[model samples]
Target chain A: MFDKAYSGKRLDRDDALALFNSDDLFGMGKAASFIAENLHGKKVYYTRNRHINPTNVCVNRCKFCAFSRSAGEDGAYAMTIGEILARLAATSSPFSELHIVGGLHPDWPFSYYLDMISEIKKAYPRIQIKAFTAVEIDHFTKLSGLGLRGTLSELKSRGLDMLPGGGAEIFDSNVRGRLCPEKIPAARWLEVHEAAHTLGIKTNATMLYGHIETYEDRVDHLMALRALQERTGGFQAFIPLSYQPISGAIDVTRYPSGIDDLKTMAVSRLVLDNFPHIKAYWIMLGEKICQTALYFGATDIDGTVVEEKIAHSAGASSAEMLTTGEMINLITKAQKEPVERNATYEEVSI
Target chain B: MRLALHPERVVTFIVDRNINYTNVCVNKCSFCAFYKDEGDEEAYIIDEGVLMEKIRETISLGGTQILMQGGLHPALDLSYYTSMLQKIKKEFTINVHGFSPPEIAYMAAKAGLTVRDTLAALKDAGLDSIPGGGAEILSDRVRSAISPRKINTAAWLQVMREAHLLGMRTTATMMFGTIETPEDIAAHLEAVWRLQAETGGFTAFIPWTFQPGGSPLGRTAGHATAADYLRVLALCRLYLDNVDNIQASWVTQGIKTAQVALRFGANDFGSTMIEENVVKAAGVAFMVTKNDIINAIRSSGFKPAQRDTFYNVLNYF
Candidate 1:
């Protein structure tokens, strides 16, 4: 299996499944690390970004979502364009990207979403706006009475530079049924992404693991992403979100252990051979495990997210923010060179 | 290099229990989490009966040795250590691999005897060998920063040299990832390699990371990743050519990284510690049974063998 990976051969479904079941974690890690080094050397990429979940008032109450709330609920919110601009202007530090993913607000017209992107882009023309998931894109298509390609083209023209990888929770239908039945099916999610890619918008991909999903489900999800990337070549990176065990909604009782987290990261790096990067999202994995993941085939540790609410709503215990200095310190201590990057992963020159 | 030295593809481990006799100490090192003040409620010297019970339990579980170490108590003398060894030797047939260099230096000073004389007395009372502890970085610059009240580097080496002259085989250890530079690590490995060259009394070279969970250094010092641990482990194997054994530390790095350490040039699986408290007190504990060690070794493509204190194979699993 390692020989195949070393020779630059494409790993099939069986090869990925074997990697998932094998106990040779270090062997697999070494192979992944070697490939990462060959591609990027010791340079680890990070970004100075802010996550803005404009509102938590979502119509579809996905069973695994802890961030969404009903319209009349106590904690539900709907952020006007003015409020989002004010929040962005209040930040003192400079950032290269604004990661905007929010709940699907039923009452807001599709123009409200389009105006939100244009307003932020007009104000901060230098910062890229990576907004909306395929689920939200599907919601927009319904709200605007347009086709998938037309909705995505509207978002693209409104300065939506890229798509954030959310709502790709698990591509398996069985697990998706139990996880978020009201949300779009796997076919619709794939169709939305494919349309967005065809329109020339690069996007990130994600998989929510350690929940009710089986190893086969995870491999199937990766293979689907691989197949898509092979055709469109639209994925900028692959992010594996470790499922944080919440109290009431999700039935999972515990978080994934460090071994499982590292293995998932390593396997993703090997199987997603077409992906340019594998991100260890520190918001869910914590600082130590994320730092260790650098050697397990991870080339990027997401970003210095100023404020993250989605994972925190699900009971994540990591710190709310890490300064750029802190991010460089973490990467440096792991003996890797830290590279500050923009939304598309180009090195951000000061 | 590992294949050249250990051509049999056999990895070795010893089944032992770490019995810390006393926790009361005067030299309150900043990086240590197991030491306590003399009058603290948790501070205690092990009762003789409880100590005997621990040894009996270890023997019943197929353990061949007891790794006895403790804090530098101000009131204990040479008589205390000699009588403890005599009592244990008189009772059981287990090898008593006890006392690190710092403890020996302190006892010699308190007893008004040379280190050689002190070691001779302890050996006569059935101190079979010595286990290396308290040698954090083998550089006075690092020792002064982390443990100013403890022994200096020269004193630590002097104690080891005297023990070696007395025909006692001891192991050498380094606790890094705590305010240490690459030069300090190189100096540490060079120190061990030079000593092994001179006396050839060192049995193994064990290197582990500093756990900064419950210690004072936790505020300023960060933890080392498994990559850092493996990098240092591989460096130890390449640099210390005189030392025949390089043991991987499962207690600090966990079992997965330790299994990977075998490929990083480690030939020994360290000890199957039936009971461990020092690292546990620092808020990181990884407990494994004898079978777990054997299985980990076998799965890593090596034969797991049980060895005595002197690295003699007793059984191959």
Candidate 2:
């Protein structure tokens, strides 16, 4: 019983559910932990990359996000290539990888993003580019009036290395309709990533936490990713993003939350044990908790983020920059050796 | 873990901010509003300089601990955290309350060390205590659906258990009203209770509702009402007999709910975060003043005292 997946245990689904439904905290924790130890041997993973969010200007203002901004907001910005490069250039050392994910700008064609990646590659040939999430790809393809294959090929040729697993929030349209009503639906998010990986572009996946998502929604989210991972083997790692209550942008504050929402964070590590690397993103969770997250069942710490704005656009108040030394410090303090990896978890520069 | 022992004292307080450090995550919960995908043109990773500065600010404004957290990005490693803790301890005398169960879990796996070893290293680096992040609903059913990549409830407990067994202190938290039933919440409490019972390490138990925004889930119409929050609070106080302190979430239910929580079971006020992100990203707008928190607790019939991350009373007001 202990060796099998909880789903496969001898306990009747009813009994398991009842056990789950039971108020016995210790029993339940023991049961869950028993499963955890059996699956993961107690290790976590982290990364060493920087997120360069060049703009906040977007066409799809998903209600679930407090980060996106209309062109008119005082904070709304579309940083020029020079501005972004200048900021990224200040990174403490040459970043091993460059992470790029952003909104679906209604006007910016796919060429704009492709140009950015191409220019980045041209400037820093050693850096691996993990740019564009599934949503951005879908949005780009739609704007470019091209097929998924064609779009991916064109982007890859222009130095687009891989994709970041974003936009596959919940595969359930019911939930998607309520949260991000206008963005690409679950299938679209999947198709784009599938296309990218089919083209040999590896990607990373993520989930947003502390929101109105249902348990089934989370299960479906993972299953969808797992299925895709099984199919293309393109997903490199999985990360969990905590929801912030950004008031003015999307009105997410009307809800309630605290640290307990972290159940979502832990469960992800437990359930997705099959996934090779799980990251504790420092930017959203803060350095302290991110450091601590390693013990539970995580492995990656995202790299030296040079430029980022989404969480801040919503309400993240932590600094947007950390020296590579600082990155190493977080890992060392957590008592782990920081092994820097590129977009694909392949050692780039550690 | 040793037999569980509820702290000799029971102190509860009003809850407030869930101040996350970064939204640039690798673990993207379907329900999160805080994380921005790489090219969303708004994605960001928090700055360490600002974090140090915020620690100073939180300490100055009579703040106790900073609830620092972020997404699972792959670049940062153990060294990054050690220095942060070192700096916090070096700069200010504040309790360096940092890291959650999952974050600890991450380090152990990446460093290829045992949980105990990882925690020991963190403690030696000036880590004062652990905060309960990544314990969403405690039930696997809920976790798998929403955050499959996060450490599961059992693993989360294992880390806490290991931490406690090693004499590292911790806190417990719950975010309800999303996909879980009362039983799930109760089970969540039981997980903490059992761990606290075994290790006697949990300093406090905080239960709050889910805030849905920027997530794939629909917009939350109305959160668990104030009365609902109190009911849960009361239940936590009553059922989590092993955990000594209960906290009210002002960040969720507001000061009024926090005030009500004191009567239900809360004995302490949560952090006055000089900064918060995740909940704010979800679109919530709430904050607390040190004076206001003390007044709220005092009015609620408990003597107000400020405690650091470890529940060590810093001062009595």
Candidate 3:
């Protein structure tokens, strides 16, 4: 399997399953690192970006979600366009991207969403807006009385540069039904992303694992993303979010161990061969594990996320933010070159 | 290189139980989660009956030794240790791989004796060998920052030297991934390598990461990932060429990464650790049966063998 991966052969689902089940973690890591080095030689991409979660009042009650709150809950919040812009203006550091993702607001009209994007884009013209997940797009389609493509085009016209990958938790229907029963089904979620790709809007992909998902489910999820990426080449990166345990309907008592995190990263890098990038989202994987992941085929350590609310609400113990200096230090200490990039992964001059 | 050195393609592990005889400690190292204050209600010195029971269970389970280590209790004296060893030796024929350099140095200081005299006394009481513990990183700077009250680098090496002169074998350990630089790691390896070169008393090098879950230093240091663990494992093998064995830490890195360590230059699979407290006190535990070790090693494409405290194969599965 290592030789096959090294030879640049596409791994079938069975091969990916075998790799997942195999105990040769270092061998798999070496092969995955070889492939990563071939694609980007010792260059680990990061970004100076701020995550803007405009609201936590979500309609879908995901069992694994700790961020979403029902309307009028004590911790619930919905930011106005003016407030979001003011928050962005408060930060003095320069950033090339504005990562905007939030819950599906039940009462807000589709025009409110479009105006939020346009207003942010108008205020910060150069900062690319990578906003929304496929689930959110499906919500917007229903709200605006438009099709998935039309809704995506509308958002794109209003300055949405790309899509952030959330809500694609695990594409298996049985698990998805139990995890987020109210959210869109896997077919609709995939259809929405395919529509976004058809309209030329590149997006990222993600899978939430270590939460009641089997190796077969993980391989199926990766294969689904691989199949889509092969058809549209729209995915800019693959981020595997480790399941963080919080008090909720899902009765998880422990976080995924470091072995599971590294193996998942290596397996994703090998399975998603068409993906140009695999991110070790430091907010979710912590800094040390994220740094260690560079040698296990991760090409990105995400960015200096000014404030991360989603994972933190889910009981993530990592710091809410990292300074650009700290991000560079982490990458450099891992013996990799840190390249600051924009949302689309174009190298940004620092 | 690993295959060349381990031509037999065999991975070995010891079936032992790590028995912490006491939890009362004076050093109070920040990276350790097992130590307690002398007056704490939870602190204890193992009762002889309980200790004997543990030994009987271990012997029944095919264990050849009991890896006994404990915190540096302020009140314990040389006779306390000697009598404990004498009692255990009188009861069972099990090899007693007990005490580390720090404990020895403390015992020596409390007894108003030299390290050599203390080691000679312990050996006379039937301490077959020493298990490497409390040698977090063999750099004085790192030691002072983490465990200032413990023995210094020179003192640790001196105790090891004394034990070597007494004709006893001891293993060297490094607990890294706590505030240590690459240079500190190099210094640690150099110290162990130089000591082995001089005395040839070191039997193996066991490198495990510091589990930061329940330790005081956990707030500052994160747990080391498996990749970092493997990288350090490989580096230990490549650097400590004079050392004969490298043991993989399944306790901290879990069994999967430990299996991968076979390729990264680890020849021993560490102990079955029927009971482990230090790392578990830090809120991380990977318990494995003897069958688990054999299966893991076999699945990793190597023959699994059970060894004694001295790394001699007793049985192959």
With candidate 3 superimposed using the best TM-score fit, by how many Å does residue B17's alpha carbon deviate from the native? Answer: 12
The candidate that wins on TM-score is 3
Worst 10-residue lDDT window for candidate 2 chain A reads: A253-262
As a whole number from 0 to 100, the lDDT of residue B124 in candidate 2 is 85
True-vs-predicted CA distance for residue A208, candidate 1, Å = 6.4
**Which pairs clash in the backbone of model 1?**
none
Tens-digit lDDT string for candidate 3 (A1-350): 77788888999999999998887777878998999999999999999898999999999989998889999989999999899999999977888888989998898999999999999989889999999998888988899888887888899999999998888999999999888899998888788888889898999999999888889999999999999999999999999998874534596533455667788999999989999999999888877678778888999988878888999998787888888877887788778899999999999974
Superposed Cα deviation of residue A237, candidate 2 (Å) = 1.1
**Relative to the unseen true structure, what is the C-alpha lDDT of residue A335 in candidate 1, on a scale of 0 to 100?**
83
How well is each residue in A1-350 modelled by candidate 2, as lDDT tens digits? 22333454333233333432233333333444444445444333345577887777788878766677888877787876777677778766666778888767766877787788778888888777888888888777787787888988988998888888777766788878887888788888888888888889888888875467655666667767777887888777888776655434443433222222233444555455456666767777655445545544456767667667777666664568767666666666554567666676665555
**Cα lDDT tens digits for candidate 1, B26-106:** 788888888998889999999899889888777877889999999999988999999999999999999999999999999
Q: Each prediction's Cα lDDT score?
A: 0.88, 0.67, 0.87
Per-candidate interface DockQ score = 0.13, 0.03, 0.13
Native contacts recovered by model 2: 0.00
Q: What i-RMS does each candidate reach, in Å?
A: 5.5, 13.1, 6.2
Using all chains and alpha carbons, the TM-scores for the candidates as numbered come to 0.71, 0.54, 0.72
Report the lDDT tens digits of candidate 3 across residue range B59-105.
87788999889999999999999999999999899999999999999
Cα error, candidate 2, residue B287 (Å): 7.5
User: Cα deviation of A255 in candidate 3 (Å)?
Assistant: 8.1
- lDDT of each residue in B1-317, candidate 2, tens digit only: 01123232333332223456555667787767777665567766667776666565555455656666776656667777777778767787766567888888887887888888888888988887788878878999889977888899889999889878877788888887677777888788888877777789987887887776556753642234443566678888888887767777776666544654554567766765444533323222223355556655654445676666666666766
